[model samples]
Target: MANQPQDDRTSKQQAIDDWLPITSSRNAKWWYSAFHNVTAMVGAGVLSLPYAMAELGWGPGIAILILSWVITLYTLWQMVEMHEMVPGKRFDRYHELGQYAFGEKLGLWIVVPQQLIVEVGVNIVYMVTGGKSLKKFHDTVCPSCTPIRSTYFIIIFASVHFVLSHLPNFNSISGVSLAAAVMSLSYSTIAWAASLRKGVKPDVDYSYKATTNTGVVFDFFSGLGEVAFAYAGHNVVLEIQATIPSTPDNPSKGPMWKGVVVAYIIVALCYFPVAIVGYYIFGNSVDDNILITLEKPTWLIAMANVFVVIHVIGSYQIFAMPVFDMLETFLVKKLHFRPSFFLRFVTRTTYVAFTMVVGICVPFFGSLLGFFGGFAFAPTTYFLPCIMWLAIHKPKRFSLSWIINWICIFLGVLLMILSPIGGLRSIIVSATKFGFFS
Candidate 1:
């Protein structure tokens, strides 16, 4: 009789644990979680940094990157804190956090579309990038084997991606992410080293200007969008956190800050050198994709492109998993659909097809990155997380924490407003140079 109350508590806790995603034995170690964060954070975005640096100049571009990194890390921790606030309840995904902080309808509206844009936009970018890389490799190897369009390669890559996207959950893809991370690091090194070797050739004009008069303010904000895109990994932070091991005594987020530190350090190490070296070598003439700017030993460049293809392939899955979960859950709960393998196959394949078609229709790579970076990245990374923290903690009005949150909220709103305009201007300018289909 004395122990009955304790037994009842244990049973209730067990019931709650069963409902949570993090209670599984499949939960990952700190290193695996760190790797997932790194994989999601570092992708084709790094390739665009040199061009951003060229626009903003080195000092401002580097400053923006560092500041973005710091703020993103803070927001990521705020997310972890919010997850802990509800105690036994699981806020294992961004949408859930949004719904918890706000209401269901509004919260979903706030997060879902932006989340979709970030994930699907990236997959489209990956398809375009992969297609281009394959075309480059094919052209280098078989110059006489007739010209193959990038669109065709994109279709072929999408078929393979459709197959890979069927992997059921996040934990299943950790090994793939690990391999992708290594590939990213490898190609980043190759691009940096190749640029160093190429140096500043006589024909290429180089400028290290602090500011540009060409587009003036428009150019600055556009460059800021590019830099923001480079660090916009907050969309998947909660998903990565969900993969970390959890226990009653030691919540999943216990080692999350340490993991975040390790991952972002690796991200900065990989990003900064590539941006600086690529811009140092090519200056204002740097191509949006730095790998494209390399005109050296054919085989090495080809190898690097191949690595980029692989890295993006893995990255597409990492970002898409959360989107997949949300859609699947909605189908299961709201639509009363059974959570069967057939349902999973149908939904996942349909999502892949949708992204593929979008990739084909709007093949403008840099423009898409800029647009998504501004439209989605600002709100998701900066504004929502800070606001959620404020709402959940109810920090004192006009207090230090409150003041910081407000400042972050303002910055997020500013970026949200400016980035889209800048991105649109960039798209229009690029469209003038190239057609929509091009």
Candidate 2:
């Protein structure tokens, strides 16, 4: 061992030292990691793509979707590259990268909030989506029963979510991740098939309308935000990467990138067909949730809704595990608390409860999706990655790489500003018809 080259020894040392407690016994094959990435990227947000397609015409919508996918893939790769920048250190969390890129304060202030919004915000969406689907399913099955509000269903789902959230870490829930990925595909198929059924049916009025009510400007921003949200899995990229096995000869990220590419390809396959077909069928009439627009053959639609609810229930945890890990670490280190089972249960339960309340209170589905996607996903997925790459790599100023990074930064900033405005406007407009908590 002592006779080995310095470079080889350092590589081996880095591989061994990089093994985190959270990552212990959790190493996954490339395909399994790919499955996780697919599950993480494809969530309840995909249901809204048709609505987004409607806002931006199919031509522009498809263009944006493809563009978003390419940009997101690049940014994800950039993030991985950033992880490898510091030779002997590993960044297993999003904020860790942020702290390295800028400073601790900025990471705490900016990156921490981004992670919370991505994780907690998505959980809130899951509650809202699962609750709505459960209500719809129940109402379909028991027409004569008393009409139960979505809020009640949300509480019921949260009870289950609280239990699931207690899973110790991300890798502990690999089974859930696999099941969620399957569920996502099942529902996506049902949705696509339903869209075809709706399109071909007689007496169904549908035509492709690019923009309505909202002007071109508003619709463009709204559509952009929705697309951004649909691909906002960048927040969990590092956590997933950490689970891949590392070897001295061939490190973890080699397989991790393979998984990412494979996963994203599947994501594109699932996403594009649904968006195009749903828009073709419903056109401007497509509901924010394409599934909601699906009604006939009540059993199938109901089954698909059930699948969505199941998928989100699992997905809520995939995103939340990192946040939970971060919070527990903070409490244990800064607050001098023990890493006790009791503390874990209390924190996880409380976090789930908080998301449940917010999900129930703010039932603005499309608006919330847009808000998070635009305001949060744009920066986290696109803007920050470019900035971090430039900061770490120190690409020559005014070079092509530098210019591209600047352009990405501008686009992210543009989305951050415009997306929130559009999302808020949608919420306000939506509120006129259905008041808060309705």
Candidate 3:
């Protein structure tokens, strides 16, 4: 096996890695991490927090929300610290880090599937979110115009990716990411401030939304999934860090962690108020999307919807860039296809179309969030990094790090198991009443 020239293989591999989207650039600044993380962590999921609060009620809801924020932040720090743990080497992709912690093959099996689900699931949900927000904007602004089907609006939303997908690298989309970060903060502000302005609804009920014991159990589980879905930035942290230049003295972790702190603060600002205030205002009567609940101040609501459309546009790209990198890597390496513009066009277009079709079939945004959140996101966001940390760092037994990692893993496993049951049931219940492509 060690017969032929080894240098030839190394050179060929480096060439392909350099060509891949995630690794094509390494000059990004720390603030790039700041806004990109913002765009990634604070997505359409935040809009669902009020409904989640309603399901779990105030006590459990607030507790779960705060716990998730802390747990995910700690796990994220593990990822950043491990990024350049082996000086003179960088684990540039999630799967690469996975391969390092686990054996090469097992790591791919463990991480890639979950990572793909998080990335692709997010894209599918965003497709529905974008289209629905656009429809909301249209209906609010032009109430008298002919009504358009959500199917068409979804297609219109997918059309943007047909163009933006060609941007070729994460850095290329910095402007879009920055704008999305701003829009997220902006719309999040509008959501809370507008609700504050409108004041709480009359006879607001703080009781759980579900009546039966079984129903309450399911809803509580689903609420856990919804909160799990909100802190979803870990999937892309390493990929985002790959863009930042690193050196032995000034490792990437310093800047990456800096950006992550800023992003998390922004996340806290966006998530806490929206979840707490939105629930306080509308109580259990809140729509799955809080924006859909608010009706007054027509122009303001319309603008918020418009802002949602813009923000998801950027979020979609942030998530998709990694998927694109993976696809291109597989094609160029395994299939031996020459990398070209045509290859990228076909791959990205096919992906967009596939997500659009799935989104069209099941446009239940809330249920999808809970389902994907538990089935996919819980593993990737909540616990996988901790698992990776223990495997790589071998944190001292009985130490604080060891205890914390185990705790996260235990909670994450419970989240993965319980939340999916409720999320799946919710999807089935919603599906029974929903007409295809309507």
Model 3, position 239, has a per-residue lDDT of 98
RMSD for all candidates, in order, please. 3.6, 3.7, 3.4
RMSD (CA, angstroms), candidate 1: 3.6
Q: Model 2, residue 414: displacement in angstroms?
A: 2.2
381-403 in candidate 2: lDDT tens per residue?
97898988887789999999899
Better model by lDDT: candidate 2 vs candidate 3: 3
lDDT of 2 at 224: 82
lDDT of 3 by residue, 78-143 (tens): 899999887578898999999999998999999999899889989998999999999999999999
Error of 3 at 336 (Å): 1.0
TM-score against truth, every candidate: 0.90, 0.90, 0.96
Q: List the pairs of residues colliding in candidate 1.
A: none
Look at candidate 3 and give me any clashing residue pairs. none
On TM-score, the candidate that comes out on top is: 3
Q: What is the C-alpha lDDT profile of model 1 across 258-279, one tens digit per residue?
A: 7788888888888889998988
